[model samples]
Target: MTEKNVLIKSWADPITGACPVAEILRTLGGKHGPRILHCLTEGELHFLELTRAIDGISRKVLTDQLKEFEEQGLILRSPKNDARQRVGYSLTAKGDALCGVFGQLYDWSQYYR
Candidate 1:
């Protein structure tokens, strides 16, 4: 099989193809996803707070990433109880599980770099 076909086949597998770890990595592999997750590590925040916390991210990109993360069950979105009832975002149990992993990865990278 060609290299492209091999890549597609691996990702398409029903058994190992739908690897949770791989999915998490793929989701968090890019610049925006990880940053969004990191921002939520503190606590729940509204859309504007997230936008302010993560520097250099465009609103459109943040909105897209937030939607993707929510769909993946890595984050939870709820309506705020205040007057405006704005939507807020926070890490889900699955997302919280990555807290240690992020710390360890950061430490490891620090050692290497």
Candidate 2:
């Protein structure tokens, strides 16, 4: 099969252990997931920064979303390596790939607002 065919087959057959889009969609379908993912578009952010940017989100919800994103291999959460108990979150390569779609959606929202 061609490379493109292989890629499509991989994404289409979740049982083959290659497809992850379904899981990603499920996790990101939650209210906080899209918000958190959107924030990562600009740059890396710490937990506090994310919480502040997406107002009305509770600490528990943010924590859950971060954990889900990490588990989905969409975002990376790493320590600051400083004295402060700081951890930073950034989009992984897979996560970055979704930026185009997210950006389009963001732009489209302007029309509705």
Candidate 3:
């Protein structure tokens, strides 16, 4: 089928194309992203704080997840004014918009337990 046809078929209710947020969800649904978002939900946090808050996450994984989230415009990273070595991450408007969806997912998971 043509690309357009495939997309149309994918969007149909039964087999609707991948979830609307598939791209972002696939990347952000990782263990690290939820933890990162939970940390930032309170306030901006530096890399060190995130690592500590998300115990067991490797430095490399944290770095990679942050980079992906930033690139996707889901989060903002700012350099600390007093410390050039310090950077903090916070969710953006787009990221905040997903809060409801995340909450629903969390609630649904409880049903399966």
**Best TM-score goes to which candidate?**
1
Q: Which predicted model would earn the best lDDT?
A: 1
| Candidate 2 total steric clashes | 0
Summarize candidate 2's per-residue lDDT along 25-72 as a digit string, tens digits. 777788778878889988899989998999899999899889888987
Q: What TM-score does candidate 2 reach?
A: 0.74
Candidates, ranked, TM-score: 1, 3, 2
What are the runs in model 3 whose C-alpha is more than 4 Å off?
1-19
TM value for model 1: 0.78
TM-scores, each model vs. reference: 0.78, 0.74, 0.75
Collision pairs in model 3: 10-17
Write the residue-wise lDDT of candidate 3 on 59-87 in tens digits: 99999999998898878999888745799
Encode model 1's per-residue lDDT on 19-90: one tens digit a residue: 666767888877978888988999999999998888899999998899989998989999878898789999
Q: Where is the poorest 10-residue window by lDDT in model 1?
A: 8-17
The C-alpha local distance difference test score for the whole of candidate 2 amounts to 0.85
